[model samples]
Target: MEMLCEIHPLHEWRGLLSQLVKMAFSIFSIIGTLPIVIVFGLYFIITINSYLKTKNLSTIFFSLSFLATTLTYTVWGLRVFLLPQYDPHISNLLPYWTSAYLFASLSLIFLDFACIELSGIENKRIKQIIYSIILITYSILVAILFIGFEVEITTFMDVSDLSISNIFVYAYFILLLLFYLTLPNIVFINYIRTSILKTSLTYKKVRTIEMGLSLFTIGTILDGARFPSNIGILIARILIMIGGLIMLIGFTFKPRAKED
Candidate 1:
């Protein structure tokens, strides 16, 4: 008699597609969420650029982060539309690069912006060194996973296996969830605390970004973790959409340029 096959969660096409779509839009929603992440990222860069009269430390950090976010979102979006031609196995690599490097890069940049713009952490060298170490460690870990594995990069594993490799993949995803949940909130919380003493509209703009970040970050965690409930992914997509709208509102309040 033939043995019954075991199905893995990753192999569940409908479920996988649903989750990926949530994440894809969550990332791409930056276009809509421009107020929070894109607005703040660019606003800080430009403000710092003008204020400092040259590309100073904050400018460099925000600029690199902006580029990384753009790259990550662009690649991820393209992967979604181009999945048919490329092997499905390669799709997992998207998170490896996008979520691991790009998201982490964005987080560090957000931290730098928060520290300078909010926390008053003026030690640029310390921030740079810390961010650098983080990027390097993340890079090394990704490289190890890519190089040391016996599994083929193009081979899609059966979702049923729930094997060591699959579990490792999910484990990395959980790690990302933790980062996504903690980092933005911490930055926002600190911003809120610091703003209490400053009494400035700058903090208002920062608060807008915080709201957007909170929504997206929470959405990412819920979707990234692949919670058992079918509704988790759906909720994530809703949060992403909401976050994007909140982010777009930030541009309306930008410091208007004096008519030249």
Candidate 2:
């Protein structure tokens, strides 16, 4: 006996839409990171030249941060293209973890820059302590993820699948939501309230960075949505890329010499 299984029209339409969304996201991801790489590459080169001439440690830090961010986006864009169609293997963990680490590092770098560059925190000891705490906390999370966690890729509503569960994964998202999303907004609001330089162009640049952070935060939240629709994911990716662009623009404006 031959059994013929007839697919429902609604299911077929949904599957087509899902595929289309995934294709769109993948294409955008590929195209979006190209400019980021070029811009950051130039930034890194210029920073290196300036550092060589002046030997400013801050300049070196800024250059390294930009380099890391550029690599993060590049790897992320590549991963979108390389994502497995089926369940991911244990071997796939390395690339996934590497991309995540790079992204998290980028966030930490920006936070450090905000504290030192924008907030004008001057106590070296205090800065060291804060940096150590952040690094150690993230390191622990990464260690746990590397050692104890297992990733499973499962399809939702016949769309492309992703890792949906894991304690360390949840912790990473919570940390990002708190630090990258919430803290930046708080910092910006505090600056607006207390800053004497609010009328200056420098302050406006800081505000632009804040806006970029807000966009990135929203995109992160959208990316984490439990909805089965792949459109949300596509939109989230686009928002993230735009946020990156805005952030880069903000970074281009150096703080006034008198302010520094």
Candidate 3:
């Protein structure tokens, strides 16, 4: 006996239409995000140019990270749309894409933290060594995640497929959440609370950085909830968008010295 597979026309049509809509949204979202990414890219480059003139290694690293993030995400979104067919090779892209943005975010945090420590800490070399160790450790972990990791992606309207390495990726983020999100925040927050300053631009910059980090943390939590809670994701996206806009505005109004 031959077994017959029956296809429901309405169900098939709905699935096709849902996929089409998702593709359209992906395209539009990428387009919308590009200008903001470019603006940040330009600011980062300009900051790096200035840093290069001054031999400031810190800013140079931060700028490079941001550039990497811009390039990686741009490629990521395009790759997904162009090759909508699910393939195992697509999973390999996760590590590089994840590392780029993670590095970028950390670089910015380092720049700010380094700046704060410059005023308070007497041993500059020690600070450098500590930061180097932290970065190296983070790099090694991301490398581990790149080879085989669990990832979840929604192909149709409500269904998602989980890749093989979910536990590892989750563990990786837990480390990141502790080191990058929690520890630095507490250190910086304490530094801000105790430090005394008289209208220094550095103080203002630190405050801005803190606010930016807070928003990113909130946004990450919201993103994590997207699968189980779409409404939460929407709220989180809005918070992140606002935070990004604020950071962009700060760059535009960055302090400049008066002509002599």
Which structure among the candidates has the greatest lDDT?
Answer: 2
Candidate 2 lDDT over 28-131, as tens digits, reads 45455566667667766776676788775655665676577667666655555455433245465456545656565665455555535554556779667767
Q: Candidate 3: minimum summed lDDT over ten consecutive residues — where?
A: 155-164
* TM-score, every prediction: 0.53, 0.66, 0.65
Q: Order the candidate numbers by lDDT, best to worst.
A: 2, 3, 1
RMSD of each: 9.7, 6.9, 5.9
lDDT of 1: 0.50
Who wins the TM-score comparison?
2
Query: Which is better, 1 or 3, measured by TM-score?
Result: 3
How good is model 2 by TM-score? 0.66
In model 2, which regions exceed 4 Å deviation? 1-63, 80-84, 123-126, 155-164, 224-227, 254-260
- Tens digits of per-residue lDDT, candidate 3, 120-183, equal 5557796777678677766776576556555655432122223334776666665664565565
> Model 2, poorest ten-residue lDDT window?
155-164
